[model samples]
Target chain A: MQKIFSYSNTMILLLLVLCAAVFYLTGEMSSGAELFPRITAFGLAFFGIVELILSLSRKDSMEKPIKKENNQHLVRKSVLYMLVFFLLVIFFFLCFPLIGFEVSAIGFMLIAMVLLGGRKTLRLWPVAILIPLLLVLVFRGGLDVRLPTLFF
Target chain B: MELFGAVLNLLKPLTFLAMSVGVGWGIICGALPGLGATIGIALLIPFTFGMSPLVALPMLAGVYAGAIYGGGITAVLLGVPGTSADAATVYDGYPLAQKGLANKGLTTSVSASAFGGMFSALILLFLAPPLAKASLAFGPPEYFLVAIFGLTIIAALSTSSIIKGIMAGFLGLLLGTIGIDPIVGDMRFTFGAVYLYDGFPLVPLILGLFAFPRCMVLIEDLVRKGSSQISLNLDDGGGPKLTWRETWQMKRTYFRSAFLGTLIGILPGAGANIACFVGYASAKRASKKPELFGTGIPEGVAASEAANNGTCNGSLVPLLTLSIPGSPTAAVILGALMIHGLVPGADLFTKHAEVTYTFIVSAFFCNIIMLVMGWYGSKWFGKIVQVPTYILAPAMLLVSLVGAFTVRQYTFDIGVTIGIGTAAYFLSRAGFPMASILLGAILGPMAEAGFRRAMLIGQNDLTIFLTRPLSLALVILTLASVFAGWRMQKKSKPMKDALSGKKETQ
Candidate 1:
């Protein structure tokens, strides 16, 4: 496998130049906002490049040998958990208008908790249900904002 | 004289009560592992939604001040370090606790925190107008430079490699850029998900990056070790007390650390965690017994605690005077200010003089509350560590859900929270600094809006960015910081290598 950029200054520099280009082309570069991102990008790139050069030139290595983590299983589990969360979110967005925000949100949380290895399903049930129900009541009922109810 | 009246008026019963609640809550949450002052303020924001900004702001500010001091409790007692800001305290604090001097460590922390909070509040009250003028001189380009200057402190933070730390910061910035382009309204990395329109929700992302991942990792450890059975016998009480002799002995260190912390806090993007470590290190080097630093000395505790609390004061100077938030907690406070329809800037002083004075006086009030509550609640706060991770995890998750939903009453925001939380977790594990990412996310839209407006004023000429003296000086400072950081890292590498080798050989 080809080694990707190790988040050095060069990559940062490239990102800044890209941002600058994007800002310039979008005709938004004239704003003071463009200046901050541009300057940040430029400075980050410069420092990163210098560091990269310094590492190449130095005879003695200063970095400690990388001790890679032996948690690929954990990483995999987390990644899978997140993917399930993403899909659940997508499903909730679709179901919200039909089923209502409170119900969908509750369902989303319960599923997400279970997928993320939430043990003690009994404990999870009340939290997953009650929290979203309280929010809809507080924000919609108390604040009196129009929320997506099935009939409304 | 006007300031004196402002201070006197703040001593009213209502203001004192608000200050106590804020500080008391701040310390309690701050003492919790994976929670900090920012979360403390974020959580309380909902409760304060009904109150007037005058009452609400001080109440929240009290929490901000209290939490920074409170974090030292966990650092000393459990070796957990409570919030990330108190991580430096662990060096001396845990050792002190082991030596059965936990009360002394706790006392020193409270005293230093109070001193630092008072010092910074004084600075804010008297010197804020002049500093506000200085802050106003900064344009977008200058703020961008300030952001870089903030990131340069990563060198001080990096114990492993400068390369790794810089990588983490840059990746964080990139992560900050992941959402829709603020100027163009085009999504960059959302992968066709409509929920990511606002990029990441700050509270949940932070909670996930700092809290969630830590909780997940700790679960395995807790299971393996079986949770440590440490109980706080609340009756074994050493009440709130600090000796003048002890204060005088550490006065110089306290002042120096507070000054250093305040200065760093004034700079955008940096936080109290960075300040505490810097203060602790500088104190150790200057101490008579530099070798005795990690052995639970009062000076080290004073340095860390003072620096941490000093940051709270320093951060507000910019937020109130210039509308620029120095840290995430300050940023959340800015949101709270906006929620109350208060825009921070030059007008903040003249237009809302009473409110402003009330806020300033509240700082002093909050500091006193921190001392009082930290003493009274120390034993109570210590019991929180015994709560199971399983319970705390879901509770936090539930809070994050509500926090997101409450913001706009949009389920979309809650969805955004989960997405942002998930992405933030990955970004953090991949070695990105969540703080920088947050800075970028929060400040990106501002910079974009400002830069575009400035360009229209100058007919799109890039030279205008440098033509302004404030912008030019900021550029120079930013350059100097980057160069200085690189040089510092280069110089420190060999010493670090030597130290590690010495340990290995022993």
Candidate 2:
């Protein structure tokens, strides 16, 4: 057990902690609402503990090595870019209710395109602008699906 | 007869137009790397919100059938399987391409795919109603067990460790418990957020799991290589198309593989890739010249195509019959049905026969269209592989954001979706089965509702699940599936360890 703790299965440990926190939060709920959550929490804890024990018992199970070839699994990129994409998305949606849909979406697309390495071409601006405009037309005019719009 | 006519009447210009366009777009998406039936269907689901069931369902069916066949295009020409469903094709297909038989590989694959797709559709048309009728007898305890059965199948079929899959599933179920309780009005896990009242929206959750992750992946690819595009030799004009005589020779291979695929697909948790590989192995075992399978053979391509496409409709059988999705794609379809206020079950067949019949009938036509379009559209489809990731990534990001927001016309869902997508990306990297997470979330609510109702009725008797015949059978099946899967993994691990250079256990 001491040896098990010496090797860090960091992600699994994090997940276990998260599970515990979620389970503890469920304590605040009414009994009617808490039943299913409690069941799921119990499941989460049970499987997590079992997996930890198994992971610990395996040979050199500390942290699994990454596959170099599988792009679907491990991505080779800087944390800064990942943070940029995440923050860009978070910021755009945060400003959405204030600025409405078209303005925010179009702005989000243009900025994200530049940030994500879309080439600077004459076609870029038109595409970034037109997709949202065309979407507004099809969904709003044709489908009557409401999208938040601003006067600007 | 009128119902048949009504079903056939989906041949209207609008529906036909939608089918062709959907199939064409699906072929393009599928021919591209990292885009498959799941992403294609998820991206298109938003567009279906405005259209009638007749318009929308046919379009979806077209995408489903066409995207799968489209995957074979990349596997043969580029040596990259467009989807995991097409992975089996790559072994034999790339070899054929190298031997200057790209045309034949493409032809055999498309033809076999069309055959397999149509065969499964016929089975769905003929077989679904009776199965749905049988499902009418399922009580709450049975439904609960059915969900368990589906989860077990997933756990069994997980390529990674079963424990990790179950843990991911548990995490998903735990996430599902965030909204108002089914039995009572009180909220659980809301944490004072108004958005939590409706629970996590399906659109955001799905987009986060499947779509957004791909977008981020595309961005990562762009940064890694300054926007890379798929390049292939289009100079050969693809050698020669397969003759009818050659196709006729492979008839047994096609039918047997399709049957195997459909049977596997009918079982919960066995996805198209599993069907593809099993069919490939079966075809090899039954072959007169099994040695030639990986050496550029038409039989290999045909078997791979037939099985993968066969699973397309086979996976739908359980979804249409019992609300238990047979695969991840079927899970998305289940979500679509629920979104449209059309739950899958007995009522889907009897109450909404017009929509249900029309949906199944459309799949038949979609297969025919896939054959027509796939055979002729190979040249244009190949060009889509060359499109740069930078442009595609931004477009997909915008679409995913819009898709999540428009589903309920809430901007909060967009934030929620991106958050889930980021977390899902990390989880996937950690060797968790992402699809297991998806399946768990989809089935969690049903399991909870059934469990609660069964409890209320049985006065908290857990034996109600065991007492009912159908439920008991399902319980046995689930346990057997998990055990068999565990045993199979244990058996395979030694071989896997010996084969792999760097063994990573999760």
Candidate 3:
């Protein structure tokens, strides 16, 4: 059961499903428009299946059970950190236009630095503040390129 | 006379200033671990949006040249390669530093880098015009086949798993088809967003793929291994001086490596990363003291640095003439060219001769600038590697996202960049080559346009790609290239394993 739902096998299944979805969606397009996407979808599916088979045949399908067990906690912690980082990015994206580039960027930088273990130090605060201000000044004043600003 | 005029244009104060600043920034980026030439250029693309093509393109070229040379600085001093292109330099360079001959290693690397860069820049100057002229004969069928050839070569060579690479490329092609159908104007996958009318903007996409993932990795590293800054101590005055006589004696090594690097760079998929190793191995093979290669030698440092920097201009040949990017950095430059409304072909030579020629000629001065900066600023550049990942990661993320926003001035572009970057990070973790995906996105439209046009021309006959002599030649070449790339990958696997094993043992 584990072998059947392995990483490579799952990736292959996802790719095949994606190919089918592309073909289904492009079904409404004219023949000329659909031709290239169809070809690419088919090629993707073909390679995905080939890789799946190769992965199944290989002895290195998964790490040794002992190593996997030992590393599972570390893996989970890393994944958690990744999720936090991603959520922060999403938050920054959502707030960017509302709060403007400077406020949001500086906020994002501070939060990110703190999350990445800079909470113990005062060093990150100045960098977090100064970099956004400097970027705004340079982009707006030096290059005359506008960043989203509350006043503007 | 045109070449002379191009030189004069490059000497203009603004152009020269921009070029020098680019070189300095590139050196800093290259000396820093994690940020290399591609991301450096990607981040700089937004700033170049306001400048003239003459000022902008040469500056980008300077960055490329300087980044390649700058990688050797950290490789010599710290034993860590600042970029993949400097991996080979670490073998001898670190040992030289350990032996208190760091000055010689630094001088040798800079001198050789300058020589190789100038050598390849000359080749690009003389060779690209004739190649562009030849490309003028390429028709729709030939173009379609050429795009296919580029994709296949990249897929075959970019990764250990060719199938994974090919699949990543297909995914990129699929992404490219999302906005609107070029031929029939049918909206395929835009999902009703008006911003998706023209598809994903190239600048943001490049930045997201190349820069964002690196930022993520840096952040991840900070989390995994506590956020301690790297510390360095260097004694600048304790190394033997590299005399001109010593440098002159390695002329044969310089010539051979530079030639090999240029040739490798002209081929799609291969870049400075491969060229440096090839140069190092070739030099070792030719040396009477081959066994002493990794044991602190100026020749070894010179060989790797020379070949890698030689690739700086060599990779531009195909990019400027055939619309085929010879390396990932060249791909970014291709996006820059498109942003400036310049197409790569005989049209560049005939219609935009001044811009094209000036850009090519600027490579010469860029190399000279790289030499000066690298020689005098190695100490300062080496210190940049000490920046903490905590600060670098968040700063990079902010800069990259903002750069994405600047491209189209749409908040949506930033969202799209973040989306693509997140997907790219996952895809890369799955062992798919990002470069293959990038090339696929870049060439997808070209392939689609060519295929549709050729199909129309041949009345829906698919063999139109094979019927023309030029198309037939391209088809044959594509097949040959894929086969060669496969064999090369197979051949290099053991060597790669051995090198990794050595690193582990060390």
Best by TM-score: 3
lDDT of 2 by residue, A1-152 (tens): 54344323456677778877876887777665677777877787788788778777878663454334555433435446778888888888788778877888788888887876666768678878898888888788877878877774
Candidate 3's C-alpha runs over 4 A off are A1-4, A61-69, B227-229, B236-240, B500-506
Task: Report, to 2 decimal places, the DockQ of model 2.
Answer: 0.51
Q: Order candidates by lDDT, high to low.
A: 3, 2, 1
Give the TM-score (vs. native) of candidate 1: 0.74
Query: How close is chain B to the truth by TM-score, in each candidate?
Result: 0.79, 0.93, 0.95
Scanning candidate 2 chain A in windows of ten residues, the lowest lDDT window is: A67-76
Cα distance off (Å), candidate 3, residue B248: 1.8
- Could you tell me the fnat of model 2? 0.63
The regions of model 1 sitting more than 4 angstroms off are A5-152, B1-18, B43-51, B135-253, B267-271, B281-293, B318-344, B487-506
What tens digits encode model 3's per-residue C-alpha lDDT throughout B287-327? 99999999999999999988998888999999899888887
| Residue B219 in candidate 2, Cα distance off native in Å | 2.3
- At residue B167, candidate 3 shows an lDDT of 88
- Sorted into a CAPRI-style docking class, model 1 comes out as incorrect
What lDDT does candidate 2 reach at residue B275? 82
Candidate 1 vs 2: which has more TM-score:
2
Best by DockQ: 3
Candidate 2 local lDDT, B235-315, one digit each (tens): 777788889999999999999988988887887767787788888999999998999989999899999999999999999
DockQ, per model, reads 0.17, 0.51, 0.66
TM-score for every candidate vs. truth? Answer: 0.74, 0.92, 0.95
Root mean square deviation (Cα) for candidate 1: 6.4
Tell me the tens digit of each residue's lDDT in model 1 across B1-506: 55666677567776677778888888877777666776677667655665676777789889888888888888888776777778788888777777767777788888888888888888888767676566566666665545444454443344444454555455456545556666655655556766566665554544444444443444434433344566642334533345779889998999999998888787754668679989999999998889999977778889998998888889888778766667757766766676676766666777777777778878877888788777656757777777655455545555555555555566766666666666555544443455545444555555555665566667878787788887777667656655665576577666665534211000
